[model samples]
Target: MNLDFLLCAIRELKRNKRRTLALFAGYAIAVSLLLVITAVTVFSKVHQTAVIGTTGTHFVTWLPSCGDLSSLTEEELAKLALGIIPEKCKQNCENCTGCNKKPKDILNEGFVINTNTTRLLTIDLANEINKLPGVRNASPFLMFRFRDPTDNKLFTVGGLFLGHLAVETNSCGTNEIIEGQYLSENSFNKVLVDDGYALNNGLKVGSKVIIAEEEFEVIGIAATGADPVKAEFYMLFSEAERVINRRIHNPLENEANIILVESVNGTVHGQVMEDVMKLMKNDSILTSGCYYPASKAIGLNEKLLWVFIVVILVSSILMTVKLQLSFVAERQRDVAILKAIGWSNSSVIKQMLSESFIISAIGCGTGVLISGLLLCVVPVEHLLGIEMSIGSPFNALSMVAVVMFSVFSGVFSGLIPVLFVLKKHPLEVLRRC
Candidate 1:
């Protein structure tokens, strides 16, 4: 621990340039590998978590047997269907006497309906979920596989509408409009496409594309690090409904999917999930599920990433131990001579530890710098299979962990040699030399 003793030890190490360099190189390589692996693991987890969080709560889809519909009248059936009915229509229904009367009231009252039977449930929900209390926002969508009428090419597209709750940018967050305005509820003709989809189709803003017998003008583009498929196309909710030709009879009673819910005061998430499940239990016409951002797909990715990082750290430790042992063995004569001259074992240990610390620091610093530069220059989509965004707390923590690991490795390496030297006689070491 003495500065003078440590300096002297360092000087001795410097005198043997080859040995010193070998130890330095070994430490550096180990620390660098460990740091990179840690950073990558942390980054992946943070990125995935952000994607899931910003997208919405995950939910289980329960498709009740189609037979479930046979028992109910159209009015009862509409209540179980997932869709939206305009508020105006709901209030004006006092005059409706039958199924035909209900549709007439809805149309006359200028009500917009969402039918879960169509594929664009997500898109439709996004447009109207904001109107309800305890709702922050929603991403309504429909899942379907469709073919281009012109090319007869089949592709899966998620139909969605631009809503107030679009995903944010550069945060592994929600899918936001990056190039143009999001789909507007007032305008059902405009559409937004994902960046990847647009690239593949040779389309851009203002391009006209036809789907489901309707031509839509691409007005915007969006991106999702988590879902590359989102880039395919986004259209107005109404347009999506028309393409599929499904209608909703009741608004508040039916929903294809519900994502955002206001956090109730003093209510735990488990309680909320249970409540949601209970609410959907009797609605045999629909299915329901819930997702916690921390435990969903993003969380799984994070867990896997840490496993990868641990493997890297273990490998680094093994390599560092091997090299440090070799270095110490080569210096046995020097160590014995120092002990014979009244140098305490503690002093020798301190000097060795200092040398290891310096080497580890240098290695770790260089590795981190290189990693940061690489992250900056490399497009995240290509390197990590997810888009890279800055300012993730998870990523920052990983960097700190890397530095700590490097320091620990150096200290541990130094201890290995000290333990061996402590048990041996200086005379024996000298005689052997």
Candidate 2:
């Protein structure tokens, strides 16, 4: 505690420059590893957060099934599978029970709403759902069914209905636009051709495509992975509603295929969904992960970082312990001299503790400096292929803990050897010296 004791601790370290530098190097390595691991974890989570922020959940009730479709030919039914019902099916099936069935009863192909869940495919219900306490975002999946008037009605499918809400939400939904621009929400008559559909049909961005006998310019061509998108084309909500109303005299503007709701958090998601489900008397279904984007790339990286941190902590402590043991073992005779000169046992312990504290402080400082050098100079993108930000996630409290832990490791490690050596009598220590 006294200045003389502090000076003694400094003198001890100053005498062994090589050992001190070696310990500093080891501590530097440990701290640098810790910093890099932390940076990697922070980067992974941030990257995922960025992606998720741009992404959103997609919720929808099951689409109605094509019932009693024996009226339409297999070719027409095949087209219906892609979100459209043939005009013949639409006209001839005016009294079709399937059309009149509730959205909960409709399960066209894979578009299904479970009987236990409620339907949320209208503007009123969607707005109500959005107003829920836990709901973060609520968007409707607008779908339309209308046959292209220009194409042959007999052989070709009757309708071309689709729900391309991804573009509407501005999230990379089922399709990602590769070549041309995506359909704007407010824009009308702007259609985006599916990559696979366009390639198979020889359609380009500028090509004029026919929908319900109306010509719409192919403003963009979107690339899609799901089979449903690749088979059919998509348009914005306004355009689709306009085309449907103009061609079929149906006021389908307020109708949606399903409502997609996202809650504020994971736990709240279920509650919000439950509240929505309660709104409808019909049967429906609920699903997860679609509401949020998870780090599909490095899902396990965070866990691995924790493991690395623990291993580094243990190894660093052991390394410090070993260095302190050697440093104290070499200075046993000095302890005997201090004790023989009437230095109290407690005083000797305090002085040795000071040395331990100084070593740890210096070692940790060196490690922090080295870590900074590596962070500043080294290329993380080249090595790990993950870019790290200059700013760290560790706050003042966490940074302080890091430094405190380092000093504690050094002081605690040194205390053991010093205490053990001091237990021996001064006469016995002098004889050994």
Candidate 3:
């Protein structure tokens, strides 16, 4: 009996091929749209994390060497007594050689001055910060500006610890190397110069460059454009210490002026900053991250995309339901004739549902194939400005979800109109027809 009903349903659909095709097209469009939106939503989330990583996700905690009032020299102190504000000197001393001379210039001019007690925090403090909750990793970095004796111009150098420099948030890792190679087993006395700096100085791989009165070989050229910890030259942390000791009257040990910190996943910039500030209460700590307007904009766009997906899903379902209602109305006379032939209401309902299931299954199957092909052929980056591809697992899951949802919608739509038509007697339906 079930087999007979199924055969009759197939014949009915075959008789009205145009009507069946129209209904299939509607279901196909809805399923395909859902699949596309889901793919984009997933990609947008992944892109957000990538964008944050490349930008200023990592916060830097640094003690500005000359910013402290006590760090000023006796001469500068005397000038402060004479009403020359020490704060102005600290902020604007880089260009002014007179009363506004900064501590950087003071150090470069008077190399013999001993200030061992100032300008640094121990690496142990960084280790402690690394152990804090929400902190991903912390690495101490040495930064200083040296006035070249040859040109009398100041240039900065950054000292990076080898193992710590390869963290996820660090942009100047091995991947930034465009020429030669990164520091390796025997990289002592070898440095990496920024591409722009190399171009300006006519330096290349194997070129000899003088830093802090010591000659070093350039092993790699890095294209670290506008990086947070940018410098003219980058060398091993130990080598930077050597240069610092050579340039100053007093030698220091295990100290770095800056500590670059990365936060764990899902941690916000404000939360990380608060944690670091609480840990280093008494120290003059300044924390900075890449939390700009653009980051906020990206977050807003994600919310909007989700809202759009919900709206599309609800509207598509409602439209398919309405189409099913109209289709059942046009076939009431046929339903009445089946009842007159002594067909049971339950059997009639099953046949109608069977037809709905077949249409939805074929439509959703075609939609899934179309979506897969579109994703593969389309350049996703052009639409979303992010490069991504659907993995096998996600693709398989997406098809299953679409098919399941289609089946539910098909059954529900068929059930509603079948019950509505079945409520009336067969004689009444026949008389009305």
lDDT to native, each model:
0.52, 0.57, 0.67
Candidate 3, residues 305-382: lDDT per residue as tens digits? Answer: 667656655655675577677777778888888888988998888888777777777887777777777776764454
Best by lDDT: 3
Give the lDDT of residue 400 in candidate 2. Answer: 55
Q: How close is candidate 3 to the true structure, as a TM-score?
A: 0.71
lDDT of 1 at 222: 72
Overall local distance difference test of candidate 3: 0.67
Tens-digit lDDT string for candidate 1 (149-217) = 467674433444443332221111234567866655675677777777778889888999876667878
**Candidate 1: segments with Cα more than 4 A from true spot:** 44-162, 166-274, 277-299, 384-394
Candidates 1 and 3 compared: the better one by TM-score is: 3
lDDT measured at residue 103 in model 1 versus the true structure, 0 to 100: 24
> Which stretches of model 2 miss by more than 4 angstroms?
15-19, 37-59, 62-120, 127-137, 149-175, 199-202, 227-231, 247-254, 261-303, 387-402
lDDT (C-alpha) at residue 382 in model 2 = 39
Error of 1 at 194 (Å): 20
**Candidate 3 deviant stretches above 4 angstroms:** 1-22, 37-49, 52-54, 64-119, 127-137, 145-156, 162-185, 193-213, 219-225, 230-232, 245-254, 263-267, 282-290, 341-347, 377-387, 390-403
Cα lDDT of model 1 overall? 0.52
Candidate 3 — number of clashing residue pairs? Answer: 2
Q: What lDDT is reached at residue 61 by model 2?
A: 37
